[model samples]
Target: MRQLTLDLQPAAPPSLENYVSGSNGEALTALAAWLAPDNREPLFFLWGESGAGKSHLLQACAATCSDARLDPQLASLPTSSGLWAVDHLEALADGGQVVLFNLINRLRASDGRLLLAARLPPRLLELREDLRTRLGSGLVYRLRSLSDEEKRAALAELARARGLELSPAVIDYLFARVPRDMRSLTQLLRAIDQFSLEHKRPISLPLLREVLQTSPPT
Candidate 1:
């Protein structure tokens, strides 16, 4: 077994490139259109189901905010490069609306941008009229869950990126024995990596089965 130490710190952040391009649709393209300076909106409302790559999109935007070539409009910050992410904005839309309103106003005055994500769309959030209107002003995109094939492909790429050799049989085992989705697959890969390291052995079907049988799913 290779004794390479997995840089767990670096692994903490999921790969954004995989998330954006592999979202099972042209949603990322639509998002790219919205990010264009001319097409850029002061407010952007993104909503989707859990594990639908919402965070990935937001992080990708934030990660590349400094790259003028990617988004020239994203050049200025605090004034123009402002980024706000709210996971459960719907739950606190009413109270949070005022704060967001002020922030948006300030960003506008300074020529900035705002990005927000939630599980539900703004109209259904039941917030203040003005806030609701503001949120509705920008373009909104809904993210859908990945199909089984998409999830498997994503898992394979994730495994490769992590320097793990996940055979087809192991992939099938995981898909059948565990929750068949990107999020769960990712967690399982991490667990397998850890188990392999601790046991000083390569990842195998028997070890994965044992791990699944003992560990609770996240």
Candidate 2:
């Protein structure tokens, strides 16, 4: 019997290079310039639906700049003047909200950078009115989900980067049988590549089927 565990392979940390800019080029461009000395924007907030790359962007921003990834539940925040990123804005507790509220207020005076992401826009979040107002005061951008064509383009690029040759038939099978989200698709792509290498087989629909049969359901 053959068994597979997706948990054995940890996900790669989000980075700027891996992020696919489908309709998000403007927002991504701004974030890529986060550490530039000439950037005058002190705060940046991006909102999108689940799996729309909001959290991914925030994480990538933090990793790129080596900034402090603040905890949304922390009672206190650092006073240093540097970049700070936090995900899931709605999960913030009272203390964290107060701290973040004050942090945004002090960003301009201290020349700091703030990056935030949430499923809802700042005005829609159920937060303090003052905090919501502050959130909107900065540069706000809506992250758009990738269309099917853009995803296909990204998959080709991803496969090329990984040195994997995936035919259109294999990609079609992936779309039909697997979760269509990029994250899930990326992981499954890696899994199939590993399976093919382990079995010394070319990547094909038959191989993907074989792996999918032994592998757990998505």
Candidate 3:
């Protein structure tokens, strides 16, 4: 019997380079600039639909900063220098809203950077009016979803990074049959890669079929 071994450690840290900017080049550029030591912007807000790479960008930014917070709860804001990448800002509770509002003021005073992501713009978030206005005070960008061709390219790039040699035909097949969202697509690709490695077989159409048949749907 062949036992499957699952590598449970966290996946490699997300980086800015691995992110497919696609049509969100401007937003990507802004994020890169904000990471610089001398960026004048104290806050940046990013909003988009789910699976639009908001969390990926936030994590990438957090990886570069020594002191950073992701989706911070009601924790006390650090007074030291660092960036704060808050994902799903809309989900913050009333207490979180107050905390974030105060944090924004402190960051402004210290010239610290804050990056926030949400499904809707700051105006749409059910937060304090002052907090909403504060969020809008800085650079705001809407992350765009990748097009079909861009998604295909991204998938191919991801496969290459994972040392998987997926042919164009296989890529197309996955595109047609699998979920179009990158998060789901990447998860499926990882599953297929694991299955192939366990079976000691190269990734191919047949292998992919087997993996898909065995794996539960997303």
- Model 1 has an lDDT value of 0.66
Best by TM-score: 2
Q: Compose the digit string of candidate 2's lDDT tens values, residues 124-169.
A: 9988999999999888889988988788878878998889877888
Sort by TM-score, best first: 2, 3, 1
Candidate order, lDDT descending:
2, 3, 1
Instruction: Give the TM-score (vs. native) of candidate 2.
Output: 0.85
TM-score for all models, in order of appearance = 0.68, 0.85, 0.79
Tens-digit lDDT track for model 3 on 1-218? 23322243235567798677889999999889888998878888889997788888888886322111343455544546577767788777777777778878888677778888889998987788999999999989999889899999888889899988779999988988878987677777788788887789998887767765634444
How accurate locally is residue 75 in candidate 1, as Cα lDDT from 0 to 100?
22
lDDT of 3 at 85: 64
Residue-pair clashes per prediction, in order, are: 4, 0, 0
Write down the worst ten-residue block by lDDT for model 2: 62-71
lDDT of 1 by residue, 46-157 (tens): 7888778777777767532222123223323233344544445655533345656676677666656777777878888666777777787877878887877777777888
| Pairs of residues clashing in candidate 1 | 76-81, 77-81, 80-111, 80-112
Q: Candidate 1: where are CA atoms >4 Å away?
A: 1-10, 20-25, 32-40, 63-81, 160-168, 179-181, 191-203, 213-218
